[model samples]
Target: MAESLKDKVALVTGAASGIGLATARALIGAGARAVMADRDAAALERLAGELGDAAIPLVTDLLDPDSCAAMIPDALERAGRIDILHCNAGTYIGGDLTETDPAAIDRMLNLNVNAVMKNVHAVIPHMTGRGSGDIIVTCSVAGHFPVPWEPVYSGSKWAITCFVQTMRRQLNKKGIRVGQVSPGPVISALLADWPEENLRKAKESGSLIEPEEISDAILYMLTRPRNVTIRDMIVLPTNFDI
Candidate 1:
């Protein structure tokens, strides 16, 4: 199974930490080279160094169109080709819509929606030329359900969920697979902005999933037969309530 990914190159955003970082590690372990892109230069550098030659660190700000556009080309220049793109960089805004700052909403939407579209657009041509590729997005359960705690965030995810589904149908004929992994209440920095009491309760109750668990799901999708596509995977903590 490890040999399945041999010689492939994968670009993963938000690779400095959490699910992105775990996915990058798993890809490397599976014998694929990884280009780790993130806004945190120091952390990206450190993790890439730890992962050694198989990992290349690219510091990127996804909020900027230019930066998002450059990610694919930059990875191609370093790794020669990109076989997988993990669009996993995202921010969370947790609060009632009326009380949430407008700027915060923009930040979340731009990164979650705009940046994802830009990155996917940037990689399509390259993947088309190769005649094969995988595009995995990190969507959330909030996308499928109405979560009152994060209405805007949920909206952003819903958009990507639709985008991924539509793109999958459009690109499957081109030998490119587009899919999403929606995890529930992951124990990552993404939840750092959640209400303190809620987060405390989740942790205490052990209802929060870990980053590595999500990474494993990503690997499963990637390692499947080329004839098979895991379109959408919803991963939740075993003890999670919702």
Candidate 2:
């Protein structure tokens, strides 16, 4: 890392597992305190406890609009300040578009798209006020290319990719940096939503990347000089075709 983040406070959504969890660890490793937010209370508390004082467990359910809205203020109150906001929480729905239930699609969009926008919306004022902050979103390779199998999931990420870019351009003058880390199939709880065939094929073809890799990419983005913003980072497994 080119810069040390010793005094920074980072709020990571979906911090209980997967990329969110990994990013929290990476942030702490770089000397930043982590506000771990997730819906899984037990897992979240357990992980935060293991992370010691630097980790603050915040149980948040992005599914609820009220909770989503409160996340930024709550994190700021707890941490005193937020130097980084990792909007990494998301759900996945795979298979043919028709096979997906409308309710399921709604749930996925609520968490993956709506909650993200709400969180970013909530944090902008605080970050812009400070005249500095880093906002990193967990995007996906599917966002860049239309992956046929997970139409809903891909669509949500595509929305996020656009959101991240537009937000970056909008916030640049405010001295707040906004970017996203887009990864190909990562190994995490979110993978549970993948079709069995796709999951198996991913395993057999070594197409799945570990959460830590994405975290590393995120850390790299954050450590860059304030003047240099990595708008998007696309990480893929060595053998992954997509």
Candidate 3:
């Protein structure tokens, strides 16, 4: 760890688990003090304990605008300023578009897209005022290539991909860097504990990816020079053709 992020403050959503947790760890290891926000209160508390005092935990429901609003300010209060915002919270419900329940689609959209926008609304002003900051979004390879059985998830990821790219263009002049990291299939509690048959299918079909691999990619993006922003990253295991 070269301490590229020394003197910086980072806020990572979905910090209690998976990709978000990995990103938070990477940021903290690189010398940034991180504020972790998540809806899972119990898990968030446990993660906070393990991360020690440098990691601040905020229990926030991404669906709640007010919760999102409180995160950055609280982080600033504790760490002085926010230099990085990682919008990595998301959800998925697998189904063919025609067969998927509308309610499930809405939940997926709300968590995947709306939450990111809400955080951006709350945090970008501080970044703009300071004339610099970094935003890293967790999208998916499904955003680039569709997965038939997971139509809704694909749609949500595609939306994130588009949003991140637009944000990059919109904030470039302000020295605010926006980037996105897409992982093909990560073995996390979410995917690992998926219905047994689905897990078997994924294994048989060879679609598993490692969480640490994606974490490394995220670190690479964050460590790039101030003039550089990793517009998009797509990481997939060689086993899965997609």
Candidate 4:
């Protein structure tokens, strides 16, 4: 039997745009209340407004350990409980290792790796107490395979993949589901910083996927029977070579 999101409350990070935004919208459509969390305050507010009463915006800076720790509690305060947590807030740094800025690398690791751990730490007790919850992470194909152009970004994602797998084992007995969606070249703000030539090449080749495709995969994971967990989903455009 499939699970239903009706009356459930989901907290989604990076909900201002891309896969996060699309997933939040889909959750709302499935009758779940959404807590949209993002650093972009104005965009978060606007999107939440568009989503109406079903959506609540929570401004969060994933770079701050305190802020990441506070997100789950803040969502709980607003919605009473968080049935789902989508740890999707992340930045991408694309370039050869020699050309990448140290600060940019730090920022990527901070958000993609540290923030994920902090957010998970904050939510675990609550979810375990309830004995039922879902944690979905946005990983990347780059995590599974090496990408010369974005080694640091790939490293961050690889860290997340390992984290998710380990946490799944640890939390399975607690009745909490932990899973990750690894997407290949989604057309989102993450790519906005990519080299113009590479971005243009990818676009021209039709290798970029829409954010909605990733959201659809997330919904599938969420709707599966409680006994059936989709541990990892890899979403990519058919035209995508890597």
Q: Best by lDDT, which number?
A: 4
lDDT of 2 by residue, 101-131 (tens): 9999999899999999989988988998999
What is the alpha-carbon lDDT for the whole of candidate 2? 0.92
Off by over 4 Å in 3: 1-3, 192-198
lDDT per model vs. reference: 0.93, 0.92, 0.83, 0.93
Measured against the true structure, the TM-scores of the candidates, in listed sequence, are: 0.97, 0.98, 0.92, 0.98
Model 2 vs truth, CA RMSD: 0.9
Model 2 regions lying over 4 Å from their true place: none
Candidate 2, pairs of clashing residues: none
Query: With candidate 1 superimposed using the best TM-score fit, by how many Å does residue 6's alpha carbon deviate from the native?
Result: 1.2
Considering summed lDDT, which 10 consecutive residues are worst modelled in model 1? Answer: 1-10
Question: What are the RMSD figures for all models against the true structure?
Answer: 1.2, 0.9, 2.1, 0.9
lDDT of 1 by residue, 1-242 (tens): 32298879999999999999999999999999999999999998788779999999998999887887788889999999999999999999988899999999999999999999999999999999999999999999988998988899999999999999999999999999999999999988988899898898898988898899999999999999898999999999887777
Clashing pairs in 3: none
> Each model's number of backbone clashes?
0, 0, 0, 0
Q: In model 4, which regions exceed 4 Å deviation?
A: none
RMSD of 4: 0.9
